[model samples]
Each structure stands twice: as C-alpha cells, then as structure tokens.
Target: MAISTIGFDADDTLWQNETFFRLTEQRFAELLSEHGEHQVISARLLEAERRNLAFYGYGVKGFTLSMIETAVEVTNGQVSASVIGEILSFGRQMLQNPVEALPHAEETLAALSGRYNIVLITKGDLFDQERKLAQSGLGAYFNAVEIVSDKSADTYARIFSRHGDGPERAVMVGNSLKSDVVPAIRAGSWGVYVPHELTWVLEHEDAPEGDPRFRRIESLAELPALIAQMT
Candidate 1:
C-alpha cells in the first residue's frame, strides 16, 4: 500500500526528551527516598499522577506539581520547600534547553518529505513542543505539526480524518508503545515501532509479535528503505 500520510511522535521518538526527565527523576527519587523506600515513593508518585491527570492533564508542569504533592504526602507535610523549588526549576529547564534531534531524524524526515504527507503528532506542553520543533529544524519537512494533549484512539481517528488519510494508508512512527503504536493500531492505522535505547518505563511494552500491520525497527535511520519495501 502506498502511504498517503506519515505521522511521527515527538519526544523520545525524534529527539532527546526522557534523558532530562530521567535526570530530574533521580533527584525526585532521592528526595522521596528520604521519606520511604524507592519502590514506595515511585508507586505513590505514579498513583498521584493518575489521580491528577483529570485535573492537570499531561506534561512536565503537571508532573512537577505531582512530584511536589506526592513529596508532601509521603513526608507527612515535612518535605522541604527547597526540594519543591528544585523540581519546579527542573521542569522549566526541560522547556528551555535546546532540543537534540535523534540520529538520522533530520536526514530521514528530509528523505521522506516529498514522498508522503508528513505530520508530527506529539503530545506535550504547547510551548515546549513548539520550541522543540523550532529547534529541530526538521519541522520544515512536515506538512503539519500537531501537539495533542493525548494520543488515544479518538485522537488518531480525528487526525487521520482531518488529514483525509484513512488508516490503511497511514502509518505512525514513534518510540513509544503507549502513545504511538498501540493507539495507532487501535485506530486502524499501521504502526511502526522504532525502539529507542532509553524508553520511558511508562511508555514501554512488549512488542506486537506476528502482527502484519505492526512492524518494529532498530532505529529511525532505516525507515525510508523499510517503507519502500512495505509498499
């Protein structure tokens, strides 16, 4: 099948995102561990995030707030104000830093630009996404860039419908299984999972084995040739 449109995931899929989060998380873990075990703190933080999602939605700001909230709860309100400030500062830093594109990200997007209607379908803070895109320089290759609040089946459905590309003729390429592959397949689109070396645990999952519409690749560099074979 000739792909009418190709959608790409932003964060760790195209560039270095989780590394900053990971560094901040180590600090969070260290602070939280002062109150309890690492596992206990991690579980409580995850639960807090789940509960707050309805109110806070998604992104680093919400995540930073959740960390502070969890710290207070875990420490019985004895958590230091300095720790809270550090977390908030880290979130801001994540937004301000220059985005580093993944290996071959620019080259591959440039390669695929004219062959298909390229789109960036990513979820994050609006300002952060825009800043990253602007820094990436690959933004010029994409016909459209969408910064979604979430990437559910409904989100994919609306995006494909809006682009006038049906699922069978569309393919989603990203590193996240949660936000990229699973939802794309559920929306009737083909999914191409390109595993990044450092995947966020929240986004990691077992690959879909023996699924014709779902394909896995070692890296983004091989995508153009792979797409050629697929068609």
Candidate 2:
C-alpha cells in the first residue's frame, strides 16, 4: 500500500471538461435538429465520434470533424454551408472556452504535491491537453504532464518506469473506470475512481465492482485521507 507517486487524469478528474463537451454536443444537436430528433442526433454523433477516435484520437479538433460528419449524415448530405459553419463555430468556441477547475482540484493537488511525485496522465490531442493544463494553473503541482493518445496498462508501465516508480508505489485517480482505474489496476497500481457526472458514453465501462486494487471516492477532497489510509 506504499504509494510514492500519484497520477491524475486531467479532463473530468481535475477540472470541468466533460461539461463543455456535453454542452457543445447539445448545441450541435440543436444545429441539426431538423435532421433528427434529440435521441437520433445524439446517437449518430456518438457513432461518428467512436469511429473518429481511432483516426483523430481525442480533442476539440477531432470533435469538430465528427460533428461535420454527423451533420452530413443526419441531414442526408443536404446540410447547408451555414449549418456547417455553425458547427465549426461551435468547435472554435469550445476551444476558446475558459477552463474551469473542478471543486477541490487545486487544493487537493497542493496537498499531494509535496508528498508524492505527481503526474498528469491524460489522453487527448497533445496541444489541446497542454493548453488546458496551462490554463488550469494547477500545472505547477505536477512533476510531469503526459499527454497520451491512449491510456493502457503498458502506458502506465512506461510512465512508472520513466519516473522510477514501481506499480506498488504508485496510484491513479480519474473519473473513468475504463481509461483510468481499470488500466492502472491491471498494471498492478492502485486506482481511485472519482466519478464525474457528465462522462461521455464512449468512456463508460462496467465498473470494477469488486476489484481489490480499485477504490472509489465521492470527490477529490477525500483523496488525501484515502491516501493516508492506504499508506
């Protein structure tokens, strides 16, 4: 239970990310409302996003492409240029939106920074992730920032090795049981799921309900005490 390093997932775990994505998506649906109902628009958009993930990875840019693709299909290729323009506008607005730190994100990081080698291991377009990290102002608390295209057990192994941290001496915290917790647990590190309300459906996975290496907390505020108990 001796954990020397703690890795955090940046998006939902550290700050308000999924909320923006959800907001943008709703606005996107509105733009294509004539083409389909809310449910259909959402489903089609998610389908586009899933397919695009492999090619574009994750980020505002990829999202913009998916929205364009969805709009074409939803509107049966008759979607006007104005609507396409509006969709691009939405993406730009999202990219420019100010990053808002989630509750206790900074305070908890400040508390952990001195005690552990803190790292931000998040998956997204590298530049966008870096931009958000820079905007967060909590970047100073982390020893390193790893903007990865994917999060897997092997990624964790490499990160731990690069930092001279062993799995037994490290832990991960994030909202996704799929991307953050499960992978870390499989890598022999402890993982904590700090659930965020607006998770993308694509990020959803059955929770690690009874995994011994996995833990769930109500908020980042509980992290320090949880780490203490684990130690």
Candidate 3:
C-alpha cells in the first residue's frame, strides 16, 4: 500500500539534540566531580528527572533545574554558587544557540513535501520545540507540527485520526527506536527507522526484526527512493 501521510520526529532526526545535552552533561560532570564521584550527581539527576516528568516535562529549563537540584543534593548544599552559574550559562547557550538541520534534512523534506502529507511529531516543551521549528526553516514543508507530551500508541492513533489517515496509510520516520517506531507500529502504521548519529540512551530499544512494514534507512537522503519503491 502506498503511504499517504508521513510522520517525522524532531530533535536528532532533523537537527542536533543529544549533542547539546551531551556537551552540557560533560560540563556538569566536571563540576560535580569536584565534590566527589560524578556518578553520584548523574544518579541524582536521573532520579529527579524520573520524579519530575509530570512536573517538568522536556526542555532546557527543566533540565537546568534538575541539574541544580541534583548538585545541591549531592553536595549536601555545599555545591558552589560559581558552579551553579556555569550550569545556568550552559543552559542559556543551548536555548539561544541557532541549530543547523541535519544533512539532507531540508532537501529530503522538500522532496517529500508535495508528494506526501508530512507532519512533525515531536515530544518536548512547546516553546523550545517552536523555537527550533522557527529556526529550522523547514516548518513550511510540514502539514502539521505536533508537540506531544509523549509518543504512545494512543498518541499516534489520535494524530492519524486528525490527519485523515488510518494507521495503514501512514508511515513514521524518526531516530528513536522507542518513540518513533514501537508506538507507531503498535498503532498499525508503517514505521521507518532512520538512526541518528547520537541517540538518547533512554530512547534506545530493539527494532522489530524482519517486520515487513518496518524499514530502516541510514539517512534522510535515502527516503525518496525508498518511498518510491514502497508506492
């Protein structure tokens, strides 16, 4: 069956995401190491994030607060104010820095625009996602931009409904194995996995082996030919 609608994931799928976080984390590790083991700070932050998902969701703002909270906890309120200032500065840079789209992201998206209904399915803080979209300059290619709190089977189903395509007529393309593939497949859509150079550890999962409806491509530039073959 030919695909009528395509859902694309944001962040690492189109523009760099994890790299910023990774760089920030390294800075964070350096500062926390001054107190004791870096792992202690890492563990505390993860625990706080797990606890704060409902309260904070995704973005630099929440992440910065989580880092600050973890630092205070790990240091028993002895973490230096200077270190906190550095983390805050890092977060500000991440937010304000302009982002460049991944290789072939713009071109492929342009090619796919008129041929198929394209939608951006992203999960993150609304403001941050919007800021990135505005900066990306690829927003015009998308028929819709969805800022979902989570990517679940139900979320895909709902989005499919709104797009006027049933799961059978839609395809999902993204970097994350968990968010972009699993839920999409569960909702009965075709899923295409385009692995990014750096995937978040939390988003890592096993792909469905030999699934006829699932296709994995190495890069976005390969998508047009793949879609042509599928159609």
**How many steric overlaps are in each model, in order?**
0, 0, 0
Best by TM-score: 2
Give the alpha carbon lDDT tens digit for every residue of 1-231 in model 2. Answer: 578999999998988888888888899888777778888998998999999999999989999999999999977889899999999999889888898999999999999988999999999888788888999899899998888999999998889768747777889999998899999889889999999988888888988888888899999999999999888
TM-score: model 1 vs. ground truth: 0.93
Clashing residue pairs in candidate 1 (N, C-alpha, C atoms within 3 angstroms): none
| Residue pairs clashing, model 2 | none
RMSD of 3: 1.6
Candidate 3 accuracy as lDDT:
0.87
TM per candidate: 0.93, 0.97, 0.94
What is the lDDT ranking, best to worst? 2, 3, 1
**What lDDT would each prediction earn against the true structure?**
0.84, 0.90, 0.87
**Residue range with the least summed lDDT across 10 consecutive positions in model 3:** 34-43
Q: Write the per-residue lDDT of candidate 1 for residues 1-231, one digit (tens) a residue.
A: 577888999888888988887777777888667688877887888888888987887778878888888889988898887888877887788778788998989889989998888889999789878888999888789898889888998888889767747777888999988889988888888899988778766676777777788988888988999888877
Candidate whose lDDT is highest: 2
TM-score of 2: 0.97
Better of 2 and 3 by TM-score: 2
> Model 2: which ten-residue window has the lowest total lDDT?
160-169
